[model samples]
Target: MNGHQIGEKVAVKVGTDMDEYSKPVELEGILKSKGDLLGYLNATNDKVGEVCTLSIGNLDVIIANRGDSFITINHFTRAGVEIEDYDVIVVKQGYLFDELSAISKLDILAMTPGSTYQRIENIDYKNIPRPIFPMELA
Candidate 1:
């Protein structure tokens, strides 16, 4: 209900692998907020076949069934959602670019500003470690 529509390109985080005869899990309950326990929404899996895009790092895959949101990396068998649908797909992963390079047109490292990815020079060290490489080079 976040205004997301079908056929829109999006990248989603990798989910657990599904088996061939996996059953569709359904849920129906009130999503409550923390502390106050106030009800957020009366959530249910009524619209099972609604289309939505799953976003990874730079890649977006169009998924028709809501169940397909938890899709496998196997691209050969999946219908509708194909690699050709995206120009530059970003799969939010690390150290696996080499394996995916065979099917990719180009690869790029898209880093964003965050505490986890702050530059070394910008960091305020509590205690300076002895004999650091780049930190003590200049």
Candidate 2:
């Protein structure tokens, strides 16, 4: 921790409570968290080997390992951390929060393959109008 280089080690800073995730000891990858955020930090550490997680009370937690460095903060509005300090910071949120957006030099939306219910569909209506949108605009 004292003498480690970035990228040379895996450093993850999680901003949510681990208890909510229910980290399984033998498995890897996130099983919950509403399909958002990388919920596998706990078990995923096993694959990396010797991954260290530092929990700063309930507000945050960090996982650090040797060889590769990456952060996983559950909260997008983490102003406590000077994101500019890191070479590459990955905030797994759809859009950057105001706090992070201010200092972010290059923010991007990295969408993974999953059921994105960004829109509602495939539902049966007992009794409703066929068309919901107005044909003409006023």
Candidate 3:
């Protein structure tokens, strides 16, 4: 069934072992905006209670709302390992509005990388927390 049709309560498999599974949990969230690439979910007032299970592929990611601005994800079976971040996380749901237009813009930029893009060096990168993986690495 499609994600939207799954409704309030649904059974989701958790853990590598098929035997270990979480009970059918109630899913709650507002479908704030439906973007082609990602569906923005505002879980600020979601009645998730304590924790909710999210199935990405075969992995079951446990998510819990810590407050209005933050949500925490506890890596499966890793007690101490928790990932907490802003609630506005991108949850990829689908594709973009105009694929061709998007590609053309990127292609044009790529053709004139040096001429089109300018760099400002010697800035304090430590001030802000880099969101993406590569940005964090840099």
Candidate 4:
């Protein structure tokens, strides 16, 4: 709906690893293009450096603004272009600052693949339990 509100057609910019969402997703503004979100954003903001994004994947990846997320333009500021309206704000972090925490009623932690991914599974355990998943799946 965000794109529709702004009159910009949206669609996944077909890429290799982007098939995770192979099925259709409900959105607005209509599927109109096939390109990378970063590339498009970069092209659109070619004259400026204020727009930045954080992508954890490599290779040709589909791009869409709706149902997508954006991080801070710089590393030390808020996570989005305008984050003053969201009720259940979702920011990628293990913790929150004092100011953001003050207005929040509850906080939920959704663990994602990062430096602390898979916990004990990713660690080198020479003496722990045996027959673990993935590593020991045979």
CA deviation > 4 Å runs, candidate 3: 1-49, 67-138
Better of 3 and 4 by TM-score: 4
Query: Model 1, 43-83: lDDT tens per residue?
Result: 33223333334444454444333232222233312233454
| Regions more than 4 Å wrong, model 2 | 1-82, 114-138
List, residue by residue over 1-138, the lDDT tens digit for candidate 3: 135332233443323232223233543442211111111233233333233444444343444333121112322112122233222233111222343233232322222112112222422345666563554465
Superposition error at 121 for model 1 (Å): 3.0
Error of 3 at 57 (Å): 1.8
Residue 71 miss distance in model 1 (angstroms): 15
Per-residue lDDT of 58-116 in model 4, one digit per residue for the tens?
21122333332333232112222234433445654455555556656996666664433
List candidate 4 segments past 4 Å from native.
Answer: 1-5, 12-81, 115-138
Worst 10 residues of 4 by lDDT: 53-62
Ranking by TM-score: 4, 1, 2, 3
TM-scores, in order shown? 0.32, 0.30, 0.17, 0.35
lDDT of 2 by residue, 1-138 (tens): 335432232333333333334232322222111111222333342333233333233323333233232334322112134334456666443465555566668887765322321233422335866574543234
- lDDT order, best first, reads 4, 1, 2, 3
Clashing residue pairs for model 2: 8-67, 9-68, 9-69, 10-68
Of the candidates numbered 2 and 4, which has the greater TM-score value? 4
Please give the CA lDDT of all the candidate structures.
0.37, 0.36, 0.30, 0.38
The local distance difference test score of model 2 is 0.36
Please report how far candidate 2 places residue 129 from its true position, in Å.
14
